[model samples]
Target: MDVLLAAAAEVIALQNVAMIALGLVIGIVIGAIPGLNVPLAVAIALPITFKLAPIAGIAMLVGIYKGGTYGGSISAVLINVPGTPAAAATAMDGSQLTRQGHAGKALRMSLYASIIGELVSDIVLIMLAVPIARFALKFGPVENFALGVFSLTLIAVLSEGNMLKGLSAGVLGVFLSTFGLDPLTGDARLAFGSQELSAGWSFIALVIGIFAVSEALSMVERRGAGPIERSRVRLSDAAHRLSREDWRHAAPAIARAAPIGVFIGAVPGLGSAISAYLNYGIARALSRRPERFGKGAIEGVAAAEAGNNSVTASTFIPMLTLGIPGDVITAIMLGAFMVHGLVPGPQLFRDNAPFVAAFFVLMLVTTALHLVIGRIGLGLFIQAVRVPNQVLYPVVLALSFTGVYVATNNLFDVGVMLGFGVLGYAMNKFGFPVAPLLIGFILGPIVEVGLRQSLIIARGDLTVFVRHPISAVFLVLGVVALVWAGAREWRGGAARGASAR
Candidate 1:
């Protein structure tokens, strides 16, 4: 109890609070912009956070996670464009609500749902992470290796529409991860003889490149596009407020979807975007007035927002407890934690309880801050939604370049950013998803280290992966996941072919 209070006191400091608030505002702006996202914003801010205290820096990032998740809905509601991919499902009902002159209600409901989802997920994280970490502590290198492989298999599941493409990206990511010095041997495998390549590519540069720069380049393609017309919104009267009927509909949807989001978030690879779609679909299936769904059902917005926002804190479960990042944003956070000499895993709880407590406190505070900031800044964000691509794209491009240069003080990193950006752009053009590549890059070292250590311990017997029951289960699960996704993809293709006939 003393430790908890001390941690709380540490996090409540003015500097930390101010950082959190600033992050919320920045996240909202970035999320409201169509070409930017929370991951990109967090990546851009990574270099900036290097100078701050750990709690303050992490609090700021947490604020972005909370606010950005909600911010996406602003553009989704006010305009037809989903500022973030997670907001895509929200657009179905959000845009419809706007068309029906209920933009204010949709936006407000989105805010409320997001807050509720985040709070619930935070509670779950606090309750479950420590216990899960305790259990994971028993895992040996073999088990950890299997877990890493299982996580890689999830890339296929994450691909959803394109399993092969996802796997290919994952493989490429793993290959790129091998660029640095070999762990078992000092020999450089893929450094291409460049001295800097010996250290491998910077994660920050890759993040900015694949997400920020690539997105900016895509935005360039739509340079001539005009700002979307503002939706008519009523905010002054009781009519615009959430009515009893609205609450009645939304409460159940939020209840149902928040858990779905939590489940997806606690796992690896599956992200808020998938949760939002799943929750939206579930809500539609359960709704008595299903026909009103895409035409502007309040429940639809509630479910999608709740689901998307639920991922905010729950993604921390795997990251904090197991050292496995659940998504790209958490992957960046993983980097942040490591940079601060705060390694996450079972030992973190035992060694850094105070910091962990403070981090958790920050998570809860961020939710409240999100509500306050989101309400006060919603109008400004709505207006930002109307900013032209021509204007916004250049600013984002410059920021991406500057953020990378500022972080590394090396133009080489900036060049790497631009190169990865082009690579990302080409990948997107050719129907590849960037998430797998990022995940694979982040997890590659973990997988390699675990596997090599396990092999060494087992005297080079590969069967060690199967001898341990936990490891065996993971290996089996990975195979099953691959087969299931492959079968589904094949069936989907066959069905499409049949339809084409």
Candidate 2:
């Protein structure tokens, strides 16, 4: 309690509050832009943090981390582009809502859900860090491999009405993920003799190409010898506000997904993207009207946003408690911790309890700042969709190339971005869901590393995964989820056939 009071007092300073607000706004803007994500934004701002006092610097980063996670949904909903990879699942329903003239409501729900998740995860991080980190530490290679496989299976099946296509896309993504050098052996597998390929495709380039560049190309195709109307119309603030029904649906989804996000986040390597997709699948499966999903369902947006944002603070659990980096963002924050002469792990908690408490207070304060900044700046973000395609597409193209180039400083990445953009457009033309491909890409390496390591530990015995009780449970759950999805799809198909007859 003394520590809590000290931390609370620490955050009440005018300088700290100003820095938090600044970071929140900057993070949101950076996140709202395609090709720019939270980690990159935080990295860019890390140097600036060095000039400030330790607590203030950490507070700003916390604010950015919280805000950027939510900011990605702005572009995902309004432009069919995800500012961050985690927001990709949000695009499925969020973009549909934009087309249907509910951008305001979609944006509103995203902000609210993000705050709810962030707040919950922040509290959890403070209260349960030690126990959760201990539990997470128990996940060895076998358990991770099983969890990744199970997540992939669930995501693929939830890919909306066509399991075959979804699985195919997922396979392709996994195949693509194997293009770089093998994780175990440094030997290149499918680099096709190009040295550049050895490093693997740049994630930012792929994301920008797949979403931003592809959207721009589609806009060009839609140009009918004249300027096309704005895809998103300007709606009033009141129009954008969530209805009571929206809250009712979104509330439960946010609640369910928050804990899932926190759990996945506490365990290192899962990341926000997987959390978003996994929670989305769970939300759909749990919904009474599962058919409403992927068609601009409020629950989908809520789940995806909540899932991603819930990772914001909980991701620090493993990092702070065990000195393990939970994700790339926390990995960066780890540097900030060390720079301030503060080391993570059990010793730091005992040695710098006040500072740790201050960190916790900063996280909660950042959540509140994120809420205010998001609300104030939402209309400004929605205005981007109101710009005509002729004007907007060119800006998007420029921004996409610039952001990618700025991040990597390599022209080759620009080419990769363009190539993937074309691939994304082609996939869209073929009626394939892009989400599964992303899921496969993200989970593929994890699955590969875990399975291989587990096998190695067991001297190539296949039963190694089943030998561990946790791994065995996850594998069983994967099979059960697959069966449930198949059965549900079969029943739905039969019902549709009967109705048509």
Candidate 3:
């Protein structure tokens, strides 16, 4: 009891509060942007957290996770396009509501559903994680190894429509992660004698480059086009108290999405995007208003918002219990934690229960803060849209550089930021997916470390990968994905050929 009391008291320190607020504000703004996301948000914040205590570092991250999830809705409601993939369902109704002159209502509905979802998931995380971690304690290296393979397989299966492209990105990401000073050995793998290269690539730098710079470059292209419009916050027929039908329609979708979010988030590498899509599909299958799903079904919005944010809270499970990241954003956070001399996984829970518990409380606080402060400030956010692009673009450009500077404290990172910005702009123009790149930068290290470790354990026997059950599973999955992606490409080509005929 004394320990618990001290833990609670320690978490309430002023510094932690400030970190939480800082993370929340940055997260919301970044997440609200069309292309920037939570992973990028976390990555950008990592270098800044170095000055803080571990508790403060994680607290700030917790805040970002919460705010970023809700922030995505801002773009969806006003623009008819989701700022985040999770907001896709929100856009169907949110944009429709805007067109109906009920923009404020749509925004309110999103906030309402999102807060409930976030709070509920946080409760589940607090209650569920310890037991799961305790169970994980019984597993030896083999079991842990199997679990990692399982995660790899699931991730591979869901990779971009191109299995090869997905694996290529993931494999590259893993390999890149291996570049820094080898953990087991003092030797550097790929450092080319440059002092800067010895630090290896900063994941946060990569994130800021790929996400922030990439997105800003793309936004710059649209700078002369126009400014984004945002909606004010108000309750109305569109977002007022849900009717009985709304509850009846929305419950099942929420029920389905919430558990899926928790379970997938518990897994090592899987994250929220699939949870969002899976929830949408579940909502469609169960809806009497199935045809209405793509047209503005509140249930669809409910499911997507809930599922996406649910993962935000739940993804911490593995990171806290297993020292493994649940997804890319968590990967960035994992790096930040390690950098600060905090070990994540089972020991973290035992040694830093109060801090972990505090973060859990802050997760709840994030939802509450969003509802209270965000609701009050909705009008202010809307007014932000009134700022002309000529002015807004310069501010954004300046901020992008500021973000780069914050990471490396080096002007050289600014150049990397610009390079990625141009590359991001080119990819966007060509319709290449940016998510894979973000995933690449985050996951690259993990795959590298795991593969190298596994090989060493097997005495450099490539056959050992097949001999091990868990490793074999992932290898087979990689092979299967290659086949599937090939078949898909072939069919797509055949269709194009037939069309030309």
- On residues 2-109, what C-alpha lDDT tens digit does candidate 3 reach at each position? 665666666667887777777888877877765566777887788888888877887888788888878877766765435565665466566555545555655665
Candidate 1: where are CA atoms >4 Å away?
1-118, 125-130, 160-163, 183-186, 230-366
Instruction: Output the worst ten-in-a-row residue range by lDDT, candidate 1.
Output: 228-237
Residue pairs in candidate 2 whose N, alpha carbon or C atoms collide under 3 angstroms: 104-240
Number of clashes in model 2?
1
How does each model score on lDDT?
0.79, 0.86, 0.64
- Among the numbered candidates, top TM-score falls to 2
lDDT of 1 by residue, 296-396 (tens): 89999999999999988888988898798878899999999999999998889899989999998999888988899888875554454445666755666
Q: Point out where model 3 deviates above 4 Å.
A: 1-117, 135-186, 211-223, 228-308, 311-369, 372-379, 460-489
- Model 2 C-alpha lDDT per residue in residues 266-345, reported as the tens digit of each score: 99988899899998888887788776776789999999999999998889999999899988899999999999999999
Off by over 4 Å in 2: 224-238
Q: Give, for candidate 3, the lowest lDDT window spanning 10 residues.
A: 151-160
